[model samples]
Target: MHVPDGFINAPVSAAAGVVAAGAVAVSLRGARKELDERTAPLAGLVAAFVFAVQMLNFPVAAGTSGHLLGGALAAILVGPYTGVLCIAVVLLMQGVLFADGGLTALGVNITDMAVVTVVVAYALFRGLVLVLPRKRGSVTVASFVAALVSVPAAAIAFTAIYAIGGTTDVPLGKVFTAMAGVHVLIGIGEAVITMLTVGAVIAVRPDLVHGARGLSAPLKLRVNGELVDAAPAAAPAATPVAARSPKKIWISGVVTALLLAGFVSFYASASPDGLEKVAADQGIDAKAEPHAAADSPLADYGVKDISDARLSGGLAGVIGVGATLAVGSGAFWAVRRRRHTDAGARA
Candidate 1:
């Protein structure tokens, strides 16, 4: 959920901004380790996919709705560090391009939505995976539980932010209860989507999944009567052919993102999302100013002159998907390039 400009006061917002900046800085350094050829492509795809899937809002309560937070899903699919980077990129694009989230509240949104959710959910996911069975099924189960918990955790984070920097006289208790209640329902939807998506990727190319590393069992051999696990072998060297085919996965992922955002978003519910509804009901929106970029031609996901609601939204979604892919791909590729350079230097 995006925290708009008016919800949090300047001081608190600025502080959150500092925290968010520090988080991004740390993630940038950490992501270099996670952004090899296999994961760099997937990281960009994760951002584009998160952008696309966020269009479909599921009803959380009678009036409020929620969309994919994407933290748990991304963390599970990629790794925790890269997952933070992916969601950060999506938030950056949505704020600047669509004005979906406020620029002033960028830090609030990233800290609450991107950082907290990714860190909390991923930690829980790893812990559960460690305690649970070692099968692939356990991975999906842990993902489900982790995602389910992460949404309300994000809602709680919002309430705390509001408590610190709320612009209105709304009761903190009410805000917490309402937000937590609604987001809990939303968490169910998040869990299902996160598990399904994670499960799909894990099924097809488990090796490509960052979290799946070290989970593969060795080939088994029978010696006489006793059975033993075969010794693990070194991974094959990267081939030039493999490098070219990497583009294919990126292409396919971008196409899927385009279809989801550009066309499918038209069917999205017209109701306001979680933060908007909460602000309206709680009267925390009094000081909320219109977005600085609200006047942008592409503001509110509409073309400047488009009349048809469906067509305007569709075009905006397409533009968003394209921009997200380009920006996200460039970011991850740069990280990967730096990693390669570092490796060569070490050699």
Candidate 2:
């Protein structure tokens, strides 16, 4: 959930900001190893995809609605380090461009949504994948479970953050219960979306998915008591291999993101999300300062003058996807560049 301003006091928000900055700094260094040649470009696509899917909030429980947090999905698609960076990129874009999350509370949001979700989800994902049967289906199963847990984990994280920085006098126990309960329902939605998206990507290009990398058992030939790798057979000279094209996948992902953001978002339940409703109902919203960018043209995820919800939402979603992709790509490219420089020095 995107934490708006005022839920946390200035001091706690500032402390969380420092923590968030440190985490981002660490992720940038770690991403150098994670976002390699093949996956660097895909990292941006993953962020854009996350930005898109987040727009389609599915109703859960009586009135609460949930959307993809994207930590598990991104980590499964790319690497965990890069995944955190990708989500960080999306949150930054949403906060600054769309006035969706609070600028003052940016650190809290990033720490809870990006750092906590990615770390916790990816850990569970790896543990399950390691123990499960070695098959492609296992990857999808692990993704679903990882995503399922991640949402609640994020809720818990936010609750804890609120406990520390909360400006109001609301009981911490109630806040924890409400946040966790609603988010558990949200977790189901997260699981489905994560499984479907991960399954779709795996179907087309398992190679591009970081988590699916070792799931495919190697082709082998039994020799004595051991198995040896099988030599790849040569293709016939006359047979032409299809050109590898990420263009199709990228275009499809972008289009899917657009549809989800622009049109689907309008139909998404108007009920306050798990976080928003909790803030208001639990008295956490008392201190919420108006978003710094409330006056921005794209504030509230709609065009200022646009009356049609569909058109306004669609334009906002499209812009979000484009901006996320651009920003994510630039961040990943810089990381890749540093990696190359380091490798060159080592060589």
Candidate 3:
């Protein structure tokens, strides 16, 4: 849920912004280590896919809607640090260009949505995967559980922040209850979407999935009456052929994201999302300020001067996908290039 400009006081918002900036800086370094031949390239696609799916806000309750927060999905598909970067990119795009989230509250949004969600979900996922069977299904299950919990965790984080610098005089306890209850429902939707997407990706190319890496069981052999780990096979000559066709996956993923944003989003619920609903009920947004970029050409996810609702929205969605993909991919590519350059220099 995007906090508007004045949801939190200036001091808290600025502090949150500092936190978000630090998290992004840390993630940039971590992503260099996480992104390899496969994951590095897929990082951009992960961000783009997240940005697109987030546009499809499905109804969760009577008047509350939820969408893919993308923390668990990205962490499961890629890695946690990269996941943070992906989400941060989406938040940046939404705030700066679409004016969906307030620019002043960018730090708050990033801290709650990007940092907290990614950290909590990935931790849960890793813990569950460790206990469960080392199978693709286990990964999916872990992803579901992780995503299910992450949403409420984010809601709680918001509540805590509001308690510190809320613009209204609402009781913190009441605010907590409402935020927790509604976000739990939203979390279920997040879990389902995350499970399906992660399952789909793992089914197609498990090797390409960063979270699934190193999870395959080693081969074993029965020697007489005892089972023993099989001897390692000699390495095959390095072939020039593509191990996995990343280009194909990238194109397919981009096309799918475009379709979801450009077409499927038209069917999204027209209700306020969980955060907005809760804020209204709790009076947390009594002092909410209008976004500074409300007059942007693509404000509110619609094209400027477009009277046709569907066309304007659809065009905006497509533009968002394109812009997010370009920026996210470019950032990831730069990181990847730096990693390669550093390696070469060391060599």
Give the alpha carbon lDDT tens digit for every residue of 161-255 in model 3. Answer: 99998889999999999999989999999999999989998888898887787787777899998989998889888855554577778889999
Compose the digit string of candidate 1's lDDT tens values, residues 1-347.
Answer: 89888889899999999999999989988999888877888898999999999988877677677899999998888888889889999999999988888899999999988999999999999998888866788889999999999999999999999988899999899899878888888999999999998888777667676666676567889999888999878978776875545566667778888888888888877787777787788787888878878988888888889999888988998988888888988999998898888889999
Q: lDDT scores for all predictions? A: 0.87, 0.89, 0.91
Give per-residue lDDT, candidate 3, residue 240: 55
The sequence of per-residue lDDT tens digits that candidate 2 reaches over residues 183-300 is 9999999999899989998888888899988776667899998989988777557623333556678778878877778777778777788998788888988877888898988888
Among these predictions, the greatest TM-score belongs to 3
If scored against the real structure, what TM-score would every candidate get? Answer: 0.92, 0.93, 0.96
Provide the lowest-lDDT 10-residue window in model 2: 236-245
- Model 1 residue 266 CA deviation (Å) reads 0.8
Q: Give the range of the ten consecutive residues with the poorest summed lDDT in model 3.
A: 239-248
Of the pair 2 and 3, which is ahead by lDDT?
A: 3
Residue pairs whose backbone atoms clash in candidate 2: 6-288, 262-314
| Candidate 1 Cα errors over 4 Å, as ranges | 218-248
Model 2 bad stretches (over 4 Å): 218-242
